[model samples]
Target: MAPTQYSQPERFRIALGPLLYYWPHATVLSFYAGIADSPVDRVYLGETVCTRRHEMRFAHWIEIAQMLREAGKQVVLSTPVLVESDTDIAVMRKICTQGDFLVEANDLGAVRCMERRPFIGGPHLNVYHADTLAWLAELGAVGCTVPVEMDGPTMLALSAARPAGVAVEAMVWGRMPLAFSARCFTARHFRLRKDACEFRCEGYPDGLVASTGEGQAFFTLNGIQTQSATCLDLCAEVSAMADGGIDYMRVSPHASGTGEAIAHLDEIRRAQRPASPSPVMPADATPSNGYWSGRPGIGWVAEEAGT
Candidate 1:
């Protein structure tokens, strides 16, 4: 007998990545509760960024995972990106060892500890080449997210070249997560150092918007992270993505109306609905889909409702 080649079932699936900001504990719980009743196929639950944002602890994540599982949804735990100390690595070990659902390995450290259980290769893991995908497969990577900067054609090529049994995912929605940093940009903006930042990043429900020379919102200085000012919107390109071999589309979390966001994605994935131009208008937040165009992630391309 030979190994089976990977095959997608010819349908799109929406996955909700872990909430990136530092929201209140109650907000986190109620958020997942809303997702439990939504139509997203898989939901990633865990902190993928700074370790200081302890509002959602390991146990809380596990509890949420169990709740999502019980609600008939697939769950994956995402590990943090920058592991500055042994304590963070220890937490990573705990998450990998839990063995409840798929663990999304955001860095090589997490991959090293994920013993044989099929895990997801988060975008933080530089997965540009087919060989990288192959290497991760050897370590039991079941699915992997392509970096946000890669254009559609480049992503299509990668999808075609993926190793056997591996699925390729992309962050089609939300502000483009450009890079992570050792210093906290948000804290500095509020006149505080990293150690005593007082969770100021939480204040920006989206992110601290930074603009260009013309005072236009260009990017955001998040806590040890940099994100595009405009949320990456791919509402118009979901069909084209389905045409490509991309398997899953990830919608990163914001502060409010995440359930509605997940539901809209489910509509497109199921083909039970048509593509809409504006995403959940007047919902206290807006969307941008220009990253899929391969231009500057913030650049917007206006399309008629169903172009």
Candidate 2:
């Protein structure tokens, strides 16, 4: 597919996606305190994963948002991906009506609550085609974060057909969130009941790595969300993304090295040079960009190989 021409700023915005793992209350606060000075242009706050991992409450998130905003960063609150109960619905409603910051609607319920109000469509919405993008734009989606599984050609096609005034954002870094379940895998792994899971996920600040029978790293198990074992590093594709009409690039938060990742991307975006090897990956995790290359999600295709 040919690249599309869309109205975009001079530089592609760098966004920090919401925290996906549970952390200690002080750790969460310190993380954002560091992020307040990072190069990220936009920040997505709030708990998007399991609600049981509540080290920080809604009020604390708002306080952090205000602090980040004070630091001259755009702040957006993210709604939970799975609405399993009435309590979840009520929380989603609260996020949609918060009125202070922009909201990223991760589910249909959030979209409904945000009708006629501007929002950013979260990646879990599975908006693969232009029609779905337009439908969302009509319902007040100022931008849409395309699914992490979407390929480059598909993104270009969707960008070409996107409605006016709507922007496209893509996940450029971190482990891809593959699936979510009602059952808490982290809890189950520890042989605990879902209701009485004891918040064991807190122990894995970056999610527990699950290996295959042969002991190959496969997936990272959070409470309910299953993520890729390898982080997705698309810093090398920054130019291609800008050319393909992607306005924003999101970097998912890690327990550590998030600032370094942001700085690395900042350098690449500013210099418009080829990206160096990412410095933020944990010692055990490798980098993968297979989904961007139309390969297996776990596969890694080198930049030169793609060319």
Candidate 3:
């Protein structure tokens, strides 16, 4: 029998991605506890970067996951983007063994470790074409996140040709993750080795910013991952996403204003009106949707009167 073709939802679901910055254990726990009442449909857990900064242990993550699940939200454990050490591999293996909750495979190694358990293709995974999406689906990926660099036209094409049973998710709001490396940029900035550096990332509730020589904020350093200095606010693009057949919109958690951001997006989804004129940003963050509009990643082209 032929496979069932993928179907688009009338409205996109809001998913809360795993926390990227290191925060105090209590703060991390409290944040999710409050998220249980938020309008988010799915919540991703586990440390996705810099395992050295262990504010929440494996058990703590599981506990929070259970709490969110009980609150009627689907929970998915996210593996780190760069799996370098044996310890990282071990944790990835353990998370894959979690039968109750699904896993999001950020690294290709984690994809192999999942062993046919249906997983979500994390943003770190390179999924640029229909065949790549099909291959991942053959390996049991039920959903896949589009890379932040992929523009709307490209995404529209992929969404049209994606294999049956696979869904495409986009990062609708938050700082775009630009790149990941083995060296810890956060520790390096303090002139310390990655292993020996004190947990300084916890000091910045959100990741620290890196400004250019001319003093323009260019990127955010979250341990080893580099993120766009400007947050990608697609709050105004819900109708565009729905028209393109996008299945889900992943909202990366911020240090503050996450609930308000999700609420605004929820309002847009429920109303099904034209895109909003303004974009919202959390405290100390700027807005940009240039990449989605097929321009440079940092440019913020304002919407026209009717666009």
Candidate 4:
């Protein structure tokens, strides 16, 4: 009832996506603790990246969602894109059965199962354009996370065709979640079996960065998923995204501090005229915004000197 601070009087929104890696339950709790007090309007909680990364279960996820709700944040449970087992479906069913919180279906199976339930169809679902969005909206998809590879113009065009009150979101900061695989890259790299790998991924706060043979930091090996090593900074590009009809902007949680990332995105959503400093590119990541420009996703063009 606080007038929905995010884009209420403005034109854009900021949201926190589901944790993409397997973090300890305590770390997850603490991260949301800070987010609940931050400037973000919507917060999504659930494990959608890997089914094996389990420090928290259905009960725990529900608890965390409750906590975020108590702190005045909207909560959503995200289903796995590649559900490989009965247990995976079971857990996803539990999340779907929660009924109260909104659900973000990441895969086709989830979409099919969530018939007429008014959920958020996640980016991993690969919805692009008016027909796809219209189809999803018909299935009770109230919102859809714009795929990371989509450019501002395309997203804007898609928004112009979506259903009424249906929202579009963009990833504004943090490691870009590029792809997911069935094999645990970290465990395999360490010469271990997927089931008995001791969950080595939990030790990495930001997931392991993998470079290409040409010495380029191409992606991150996070358990069974591969993420771009570079943090996607849509800060300078926010205006274009907003104009493109993006309703919600997303910031994925890195190991260090998620609050700052969320706050920075909040500033952009509020359309503050003054600019902010960009992320310091680490050796492993040459940050780029080319995806917003409609080129290759990794291709980034420098912003105007003042922008």
Candidate 5:
């Protein structure tokens, strides 16, 4: 195993990614209110999935950002991944123009729009190469969230010679975002049209799980995003990542146990060791870190004892 980097605790920040799944207004507000006191150093706000979700408007997101900022957490507003209409473009423009906090650019158009302003390159941006990362840095990107599919060695390779002042972040826990489409999958699951989804996704705070033919949990369906049914657990790999130049570990929000997850990661960072294999998962749960080891995304590679 590699040695841990960063002699200072402030160098490695923990981030809470934007809520990918839609929850009611009260639930969303309440989630962040509690998160305001979490051990996290950053909080990403805004709807990154379906644009039709109005439970929290731009103003509401701004309010949440301000609240988190006041609590001493760095706040970044994330843009939606699959922007479709003129309205989407308008909203993206509005977010980029906020000028108060950093914006996480989900679309290439967002990258083009945010030129000359420091921004966050979201995981959805497909930033796979050092050159691309450097280009984004040249465009004023100060940090980037590495895609879930990018493995440790690849991450090391990218970070080894990455542009100066550009920080690297990786998803350390939660359902891995696999893909996004123009179609509304959760609405389709309930036999509803995209235009009239009736907000079916609201019923599933985490996401609707789609299983295999053998009844094994497989994929998670959000409005338009397909995520891994099995939550990705890289808790055991945090030390290695820290050693490899990762500056941040992001915990994707779930309807339950988010705080506990953040607390556990903080504990691991402080102790600089592997956490006891995460609270026993469900029978159908398939926790994985193979992608981090350069294998198939769903496969788990166990660590040898006392590395």
Candidate 6:
């Protein structure tokens, strides 16, 4: 069958991506408690990063999902980006078979585990074309998040040719997850083995920022995941996204100021105007939107540049 054409929603939707960092159990609960009352239309839960961060097990995530559902928000469970061990596969199976909440499949293994059940294609699924989107839709993907490195025009083209009933989501905010490895960089950074690393990632709630020899901010290391040094803020592109048939704008969770960030984006979406480049990051962090404009991932292209 041919790939389905893109369909736009009457109103733009905002989703909270899965928490990529490891926090204490209380902190995680507290964060979602606040999210239950936020303007976010959907909330993605579960550990999409390393599974060693066991602050919240699958049951705990379900509990949070139940609470959020009661608050009138849609919830999804996200599988890990990298599935290294049998334990990971087992967890993925548990999440896929639950049939309670929707699942976001980050890897193909998770996709297969879902057994044609409706799920969301996560950013790491590497879907970059209409054919791939169509294949995923055939496998029961209700929506697919564009890869972080996909440029804006490319996303528009893909959206234009996407399969029917498959909505397109974009990562409009947060430090972009660049890559994943079986080896935990955080463990190596701490001079310990990956298995004996003693949960050091929890120390850096926002991931550890790697710097160049010249002290320029480089990649951020969060266990097995490598991320951009600067947060990707596409709030300024909300109007363009709406014009291009994007269905949802995703904001990855951060340690602080996420509530305010969600609020700011909500206001811009409701007003249906050009965004004013609000402060979504902490005072110390930098913001970049170059990937959306077909520039280097670290570069920030101004709205007036139009290039």
Decoy 4 TM-score against native? 0.91
| Tens-digit lDDT string for candidate 5 (143-188) | 9999999988898888787899999999988889999988999999
lDDT of 4 at 154: 83
Better model by lDDT, 4 or 6? 6
Q: Which run of 10 residues does model 1 get worst, by summed lDDT? A: 277-286
TM-score of 1: 0.90
State model 4's lDDT: 0.77
Q: What would the per-residue lDDT of candidate 4 be over residues 206-276, giving only the tens digit for each residue?
A: 88887889988777888888888777777666665676688787878777646665666566556544334
Q: Candidate 6 overall Cα lDDT vs. reference?
A: 0.87
lDDT of each: 0.79, 0.88, 0.84, 0.77, 0.84, 0.87
Point out the worst 10-residue segment of candidate 5 by lDDT.
Answer: 275-284
Candidate 6 per-residue C-alpha lDDT over 150-191 given as tens digits, one digit per residue, 9 for 90 to 100: 998999999999988889999988889999998999999989
Location of the lowest summed lDDT over 10 successive residues in candidate 4 = 1-10
- Candidate 4 C-alpha RMSD relative to the actual structure: 4.2
Error of 3 at 235 (Å): 1.6
Give the alpha carbon lDDT tens digit for every residue of 59-143 in model 3.
8999999999999999999998888998788788888887889999998998998887799999889799999999999999999
Q: TM-scores of all models? A: 0.90, 0.94, 0.94, 0.91, 0.93, 0.94
Clashes of each: 4, 0, 0, 3, 0, 3
lDDT minimum window of 10 residues, candidate 2: 2-11
- Residue pairs with backbone overlap in model 3: none
Q: Residue 287 lDDT in model 4?
A: 64
Local error of candidate 3 at residue 169 (angstroms): 0.4
- Candidate 3 to truth, TM: 0.94
